[model samples]
Target: MSEEKYTLETVLSVKRWAANLFSFTMTRPSAFRFTAGQFARIGIQVEGELIVRAYSIVSSPFDETLEFFSIVVPEGAFTSQLQYLKPGDQIYLEKIPYGFLTLARYQEPAPHDLWLLATGTGLAPFISMLQDFETWQKYRHIVLAYSVRTQQELAYVDRINEIQNIFGENGAEFCFLPIITRDPFAKLNHRLPKLIESGDLEQEADLKFNVESSHVMLCGNPQMVEDTKEALKCRGLIMNRRGVGNIAVENYW
Candidate 1:
């Protein structure tokens, strides 16, 4: 792999999501630019060694600062160091942005219900998409199907209302369906595949799961993406070849 060109950025804030999860905002260089769904390699220098990992941008490009959600693996190579950062601290941020999960990859001539399925920290890009104007203009009905192992791990809880308001008149078409697997008291307590296969996802979104009428985006866990892809494929959905169908995936794990 090519070495990433790194730059210094000051941490603006850091907040915990759960015991093992946290989010931090950092100063964005005026020259740094990216699509809503792109990612950047960020790390810190210790004893002259530059350690970093790629993370999806959670903040909207329109925002003044950049944000990221991360899970702290106590013994992880990069994350173990990442968890030590605090406000006013500086970290290495790669100058260039990269990823293929942006809305521009959708190859259809007409619009369809944009389905954003995420688990754990995979909800980053979809949150960025909701903040951008292009996603609102492209799909009339936007369903965010977020599944987390626990309810507390669900980041950006307050943003759901703001996202709907961003849709303006079509705000009614925007839906946020949060699924928690271990929470029995929660309304939905199944994984994405079980939910999609059993038709529960469609029932909650109040929309049909048709290949022609919907485009799906998957992110976060690799196994979840794989299982969900099989479920979607059984429903006639396939990965868009040269921008043909509507399924796109990004495996963060």
Candidate 2:
């Protein structure tokens, strides 16, 4: 591993979605540059040592400020210190950005539909992609499927709505599907893979995904990514490798 260039930044805002989920914004340095879907190593001092974790970038590159979404594990060493952050508090960031989940990774023939699947804070990168101009220009239709234990765990609804409206403004087709596995409010109450395997996802999108013209991006839980990848494979979607295939995944593990 390369030595990290730790940059000091200040927290600007914090929004808590649930007991375990939260998001925060920070001061972006003028020299910092990254793609919308990339992640950065963020840290805070605990005791006398530095503890760090990689968080997907929630703010688009075009935005002047920096943002990150995180899940607070009750006993996590990093989150223990991170959860206490306040506005004006200091946070450290690695100068270099990293991640495979980005628009730049999916090259060549534009997909007819771009499916962004996320669970929990996994929605962070997709939010960044949606906020950027390139994503809107790359696909004719965008389907965002965000799954959580309950609808209450769905963070950044207002920001999501704003992006959907922006897509609407451009006369583009955008579908935001919220799947709550623990909620019985809707009949389609299965996990993302099951929903796709059973065709509920296609029903919701009103568009079918063909091998040649459909791109899928997965993030969030590792198991969800693997299982969903298998489900998507049944539909002929291949995982991206060395610049091939139609699926891009963020393996945060």
Candidate 3:
């Protein structure tokens, strides 16, 4: 790897949400630029080798520092070291950002409602998108459905609530649905694809999904993305291609 392609950044802080889930903020290089829904290639040194991985940006594009949400996979090469990150620790960031999941990509048939479906750390990009002022101004209604294995894995609840409050006060219709699949006592206890298949998701949000007005963005586990895509397709929605269609997706892992 060329040194010119990446820059060294300092970790500003790290917050652990659970035994395996955490979020960290790092100093953003002065010239680093990225869209609201993009991922960054971050690296950490382990045993004299640089281990790198792609993590979706969790901070707003306008924010001075960059943030990311991560899950510590047991004995995983990159995350094992990443989970131990501390304030002032040095990490590596690629100079350029990459991703095609931004809302600006939806152009041909303009959408009126925006649906953000995510599971686990897949919620990272959507969080960044919601932080941007343009997201609230562009869509009349927005629904964010986040699913996790357990309640403990549902990260960023307070931050999501804060964003909802800030945008809702301005008349932007935003609904946040949290799904806990492992907890029987949770309000929404089914998987995302199943919820969509059963109409429970729409009923809970009080919003209908249609090809004409709904633009859906899916992220998180590959199975959830794939299954949800199939479920949405059954409802007449198509993947966004060449600036057209109703769905956009990214696989978190």
Candidate 4:
């Protein structure tokens, strides 16, 4: 890791979600430069040892500062320490933010929707982009699917709901759908592949997933990412590469 240090200039109120799950917002470092969907490696010094983990940026790039939404995984090496960090503490970070999920890689299909499929902390990047005005300027419509184990894990729902409620009347569209696997509150109780097959996904959002007209960005648990990609491929969508097509994905696990 590079020998760099960042000061936590401010620590917003710590908010709790479910049992043992909490999120904190920290002020961005002046040196951090990242796109809406990129991630940064962060760490803290513990007994002279460096403990770090990669985290997606939850705050929009257009904002003056950065923020991240994270879960406190008990006994998790890095998160354990991070949960205790206070305002003004020094946090280590690698200057570069890198990931494949950025909008620059996707080709806009004419008059189609941009689907951002995420689960758990994977929702981070989508939050960053949805808040970004550029995303609305690029895609005619945007659909964000956030999957979690339970309804309580559906953090940031209020803000996302507000975003949709505020801008939904315009030409651009926003839909926030929460998927709870272990609870009855899920809009689509099954995973993405099942939802795609049964038409539940399209019916719920009033959109279709045609390869020629849709751009899919996948992020989340490795299993969910792989399954969603295979399903999309079966439906004729190709993975996005610099020289190829536009089905981008990132593994949050």
Give the top-scoring candidate (TM-score): 3
All candidates in order of TM-score, best leading: 3, 2, 1, 4
Candidate 4 C-alpha error for residue 14, in Å? 2.5
Quantify all predictions' global Cα lDDT against the true fold.
0.87, 0.86, 0.93, 0.77
* Model 4: per-residue Cα lDDT over 50-86, one tens digit each: 7778888888776766677777778788777777766
lDDT per residue as tens, model 2, 42-151: 88888878888899999999998999988888888998678877899998888889887987776643656789999888999999999987688768889999988977
Q: Give stretches of model 4 more than 4 Å off.
A: 1-10, 108-111, 166-171
Which pairs, if any, clash in model 4? none
209, model 2: CA deviation in Å?
A: 1.6
Model 1 regions more than 4 Å off:
1-4, 170-172
The TM-scores of all predictions, comma-separated, are 0.95, 0.95, 0.98, 0.90
Deviation in angstroms for 39 in model 1?
A: 0.7
| TM-score: model 2 vs. ground truth | 0.95
On a 0 to 1 TM-score scale, where does candidate 4 land against the true structure? 0.90
TM-score for candidate 1, residues paired by index: 0.95
